[model samples]
Target: MIYDLLIVGGGVNGCAIARDAAGRGLRVLLVEQTDLAAATSSASTKLIHGGLRYLEQYEFRLVHEALAERELLLAAAPHIIRPLQFILPHEPSVRPAWLVRLGLYLYDHLARRKRIPGSRAVTLAGSAFGAPLAGAYRLGFSYYDCRVDDTRLVVLEAIDARERGAELRIGAKLVGARRDGDVWRASISGADGRIESVGARALVNASGPWVQETLTQRLDLRSTKHVRLVKGSHIVTRRLYAGDHAYLLQRPDKRIVFAIPFETDFTLIGTTDVPFSGAPGPVAIDAEETDYLLDSIRHFFRVEIGRGDVVWSYSGLRPLFDDGALKASVVTRDYAFDLARAEGAPALSVFGGKITTARRLAEHALETLAPFFPRLGPAWTAQATLPGGDLGPGGFDAFLAEVTRAKPFLPPSLARRLAGAYGTRLWRFLEQARSMDDLGEDHGCGLTEAELAFLRAEEWARSAEDVLWRRSKLGLRLDGAQQARLGRCF
Candidate 1:
């Protein structure tokens, strides 16, 4: 059977498109080269933010749309997306206090922010949030952003797409595509060297950093240049501060680094702007990038962080639109699509989108393709809840309480983690297990044999990496021996 839409990537954009299109009554199919969000989507900064820093570049429209979407996402998936407070230390040398205040004001007002709190100023000497900051920093500003389980977000979308009649194939790599009259014929090769061909009415390339590679090499499509590959890396260390609040540290070179409260016991410090010519899949944090991130965190906080403190590190390439910008940080985070139709076949190539704006991008993409499918259903995903996001009216805490009551033997920490990751859908696994024994052997950090098996069966987890790195961050809690043991199990 020919699908109405065939999405080539299973990252945020592709998953979002699949969900939207499927919800619109179109038959959809999504193919992923690796596990869902095993690449750039899983390796993001993990913030559903409007990017307050973009205000300096006068990207008001982008910031406004992103900020508006932040609240929408939080409402749609409260279990996975929640509000986070960012503490920005006032650094007069880097940016004037008044200027920062102005930017914060603009950030708060640019969008329809009903659920997230507005910005506020705090005194470093008196406020609880400033206890870990350097004594020289007397004042700070706190604003709202949203934190997301980025990998779970993608998976939820894929699940929702499947529920809405979309076929999702993981570990399926798109090898070739060509137009044949009114349809597009595509071939996908699985990891085990199994190849399959499918036909679709339209094709979508949402390959993130590999957008260009997919266009030029796989589909053999031509379009004017877009997408500048910029490498951003993150390091995970032990918790730096004592609060739920995260810090936005300003570097001496006018760059900003995030020191976020990660998991329950760790802090995630990130991100350097460097040009990347290397392959996106094998991107790793270099020694210099690690040192640079460490130095930036050490500069503002009273706590001294070094390479020894880092437990885990990851790197991902950002697909920014090339707007003749020399600096990586200055490049616009906005996205653009190249829609080309040859003979009667249509191919849509998406480039330079962030996790925050994926829904809007998908909606616009469908609108752009509406001319081809004139009989397609109208847009319907704006207010739709993603799979496992049907938390009813009480919110995440209520759902967690319900899950805990259902599975009293589950540890509080483990229950909360599962509820956050799977939302109301935790019942599927918990309902079968009567006691801790039924949960199976612990694979470190609340990850159990039962949970791993559930992931493999339901979430398409084919390898250990899919469970440890993408489905969850259990790798940080497990030692080498434990990882090896789990690897063998997989």
Candidate 2:
């Protein structure tokens, strides 16, 4: 049987496209080389903003579209994607206060904000937001963006796709594909050294950093458009400040650094825009990148952060469209698609997209490939809720309350964590367990044997990293011994 679509990569773009296509009544198959979001998607700064910094580059359309999608995402998945307030401390040396206000105004009104509030001016002195900051930085502007559990977002899309009848094959690497008359036969190698062949009428390449390599080497297809890999690394440390609000600091180099509230106990600081040229696999934060991030944090906050203060660090490569930009930060974050058809089989390659616009990108991708499959349904993902996102009209807090009330045996913190991570789907495991002992062996950090088993059985989590880092951020809370113990379980 020939599938209507076969997607490469299991990042946000690929999973989102698969979910959309399957909902459109198409036979879809998604193949990923590793676990879902094992690369760039999971390693994001985890914000769903309109790329406020891009506005400086005059990327109005991109900002507007992203803001619109931000609203939609907040509504669709409240548990994972929620509104986050960003405080931009005034730095006269970087830009005047008025210029900052003007940018905030544009951001607020760029696309009609629904639930998110507009921007406003505020004083940092004597305020909770400024307690962690130096007295020198008193005045600043505040705006709203969003914080998301990036890995969960990717996994949710894949789960939704599978629920909608799309076949999801994780740990399957696409080795090669060639057009065979009206159908394309693709070869994929699994983790166990087994290769399998599948056929599809249309193919999609949403391999993130691997987009160009997949096109030129895997498929042996020639395309003039190439992707530039830009590495963005983040460092997680103990909570630097109080309150749920985040900070957007301006560097002397004109680049922006975000110090956001990460887990309940950590502050996430990141993102350097350095050009990279090498294999886009398992990128680690170098000493220079670490120093740069630490310096950026030290420059803004009164707290002194050093390399030793770093708890955990991660890096991801962004596959930006190579448009001759001298700086990696200036390269377009917008996505571009190259469509080629030969022997009646079509292949569409995607390049340079952020998590904010991935949903719209998938919609547009389907629209681009609509002509190839006439029976495909219309766009429907905008108003739809992702897997486990159905909290009804009561919202996340009310849902958590309901879960706790129903399962009085659950601890408040554990119940809250489970509700936020799984939302309505928490019942799949919780309904069976009566007490903490029923959870079967605490792996430390609130991760239980039951949860790990659920991840392996339901979410396709295959390794310790997949469970600890991608499935949930239990890695940050667990010690080295605990992590090794968890690893032994798998």
Candidate 3:
């Protein structure tokens, strides 16, 4: 059967496009070379902000569009996405105070922010928020963005797309493709060495960093547009501060690094934008990047951390559009589409995009493909709730209270974690469990056989890495032995 669309890549954009296209009465098929969000999507700084840094580059339109999506996404996925106050400490040596204020002002008024609070100046001296910072950083600005579970967001999108009659082929790599008359016949290889061929009227290249390779290597197609691979790495350390608020620190070089609260027991710092020349797969954070991140924290906060304090680190490649920028930092974070329809079937390739604007990107992608599939329905995802996102009128806090209240026998921390991760669907798996034993053997860090079964059956989790890292961030909490046990179980 020829599908209306066959999307290559199962990252956020691909899954998002599948969800959008399927909801519009289109038969969609999405194939991922690896697990869903195993690449750039899972390795983000994990924020749904308006790209406050883009304001410096005069990217008003990008920031405005992202801020609008931020509000919509927060409402749509209240369980994973929530408000995060960013403390931008004044660093006169880096950027002038007036310039910072101007950017924040634009960030506030550039879009109609309904739920998120607007930006404001604050005195950091002797305040709770200032305790972690040095004495020199007395003045600061507080603006709101959002923090999200990046992996779960992708999984949820794929789930929604599949429920809408889209086929999600995870662990399936597109081996080759050729345009055949009016339809494109593509070859795919599954993880177990099974080969399959599918046909589609149109194709979308949403392969994140592998966009160019998908066209030139896999499909034997070429385009004028190219992607610049920028590597962004982050390091996780023990909790650096006590507050929920995150800090946006400016360096002497003018690049900003974030120090955010992570996993309730650790601090997440990262993201160095360096030009990467190596292959994208199996990317790891180098020692130099780790030092650079630690130095950024040492420059701003009073706390002194080093490699000894580092617990976990990850790096992702951004398939940014090559606009002839001299530095990787200045490369545009915006996305562009390259539509090539020559002789036979049409194929659309996505260039650059961030997690904050992925939904809008999908919408724009559909609009680009509207000519090919004219019967597509009107856009409806803007007001839709993702899987398990509905928690009634009270939202997350009320939902958490209800979960813990209903399952009083369960540990409060485990219940809260389950509720936060699964939202209204937490009870679906927990309903049968009366006590800790019913949840099955603990693999440490609150991971249990019951939760593992749910992830494997519902979320398409195949490997232990898929469960420990992507499904939830239990990797940071689980030890070597626990991880080994988890690997053996699944």
Off by over 4 Å in 2: none
- Indicate the TM-score of model 2: 0.98
lDDT of 1 at 400: 89
Give stretches of model 3 more than 4 Å off. Answer: none
Q: Give the lowest summed-lDDT range of ten residues in model 2.
A: 129-138
**255-350: candidate 3 lDDT, tens digit per residue:** 999999998899999889989997667688888999999999988889978899999999899999888889999999999999989778899999
Model 3 earns a TM-score of: 0.98
lDDT (0-100) at residue 149 of candidate 1? 91
* Model 3 poorest 10 in a row by lDDT: 278-287
lDDT (Cα, 0-100) at 301 in candidate 2: 86
Write model 2 residue lDDT over 320-423, tens digit each, in one string. Answer: 98888898989999989999885579999998899999999999999999998888899999999987889989999899999988888877888888998998
Clashing pairs in 2: none
lDDT score, candidate 1: 0.89
- TM-score to true structure, per model: 0.98, 0.98, 0.98
Candidate closer to the true structure by lDDT (higher is better), 1 or 2: 2
